[model samples]
Target chain A: MPTHNRIDATKVGDVTVVTFTDKKILDEAGIQELGAELFSLIERDNRRSIVLNFDNVDFLSSAALGKLITLDRKVKQAQGRLKMCRIKPEILEVFQVTKLNKVFDIRDEQDEAIAAF
Target chain B: MTEQSDADVWRRVIDLPSERGSNREVTDDLLTQLKVFGWPPSDVFAVHLAVEEAIVNAIVHGNKLDPAKRVHVECEVSADRVLVSITDEGPGFDPARVPDCTAEERLEAPGGRGVMLMKSFMTRIEYNAKGNSVVLEKRRT
Candidate 1:
């Protein structure tokens, strides 16, 4: 149901790496599509481990952050793990400022995130 | 110091319909203008994030995503600072009363984080008496 060019998903072993291709994830439709697609992966498809790579996203809205929080909660409830990697420094500054860096598992590289599992 | 006229500064004023995709378009346009003005990437990132949060709050929280309402954005970019004001036509609420999102109990609550993020990224923030309008300012650092 998440029909959009905003996100690209790939499987690296047992991990689903969802890289956001959009420079800005501000539109409600794209944000919703992302949330839906990730939700389906964990809840329906039963993908236990996920890594959201933000290497390409230069901008994101609070709505999108809120959606990520929801997805993280869903993953935890399902006993799955969710990690984020390759977040731009500007974006990572947001997580640090909000203290969300403590809430989620974030890494500096995709390989690091994958190895954590 | 001599006062500079409005023409001396880059300004963008938009009265947008409370539509879903309006925030993205406005943000893109604002960032482009800021970039053209030669703002540092770090400063641009901060201002961009703050503006996005402010617009989303105005459209979603203040106006409740009602198409009948309108959101007004005024952006003024200068060599030393960027000032952006967002006003929504809706029943305003007190920003002071917003619960702290950084608190342990409220971290997971989807609300208040936008306000927190806006306050965090912008160097100076102020709300109007009615609380329907917010101004975010960031001095080049």
Candidate 2:
């Protein structure tokens, strides 16, 4: 069995800050759960901005990236925004390689990511 | 008759759905298992990426979203290395035909980085001729 990683979310002002504590996010089940959770947050709270804090995350898989992309599209469709912060170098490389850096607003710090809204 | 000695080998098998969403949980579990087996953070990350790539390919391309089909993942860990094998039920594709992610035109593509990440992180990678199976190994220092 794979590790059970934790994801925590809190509201800071009008933005929803989601923190991923999982070191690795791979496979389909985990991604689906995460996607559903994020979507519910957006739908229930009417939040216009999202700050995804990856401070404890060390790696992310393409499957995970796909979910993020889906969330990004949803956020944009709602005229809200999704921002990523504290991405590890390795994970950041994945974003760069996939050219998702251009698709989502990414920052090096949580404060910067939140302030971008 | 000689007695067989127990060696420090770790093994696990996981059933993966053909859907793309299950990839994250399996990968997280696998990485945690590796860490419990004493792999360093760097080695764990590398193996994790390689495994993700293989599983993604198996689900997205090999199985083609066939929910009835399943992907099998196996991992073997020794004192100094780890080996991961992923097998899919669908007919495999030619690994050679896969576009190089580093190529100029495809560099901007969002999905092609899986193979590149697997190659870059693992010590060795090989695909069976049927393309239904991929085996990856990472050596821990």
Candidate 2 residues lying further than 4 Å off, grouped into runs, are A1-8, A21-24, A41-44, A56-59, B1-38, B59-76, B99-113
Task: Report how closely model 1 matches the true complex, as a DockQ value.
Answer: 0.69
Off by over 4 Å in 1: A1-5, B1-7
lDDT of 2: 0.77
Interface RMSD of each: 1.3, 3.6
Q: What does candidate 1 score on TM?
A: 0.91
Error in Å for residue A53 of model 2: 1.1
Instruction: List, residue by residue over A8-102, the lDDT tens digit for candidate 1.
Output: 78889999988887888877888888788778888777888999999889888878888888988999999999999999998898888777888
TM-score of chain B of 1: 0.89
TM-score of chain B, per candidate? 0.89, 0.85
**Steric clash count of candidate 1:** 0
lDDT of 2 by residue, A1-117 (tens): 123235678878878788875665754676778777777766766767999999878667876787787788788889999999999887887777666787778999988887888
* Local accuracy of candidate 1 as per-residue lDDT tens digits, B1-141: 122336448777888888777866667766777777788898898998888778878888889989989998887887778898999998888988988887888777655677888888889999999999999999888
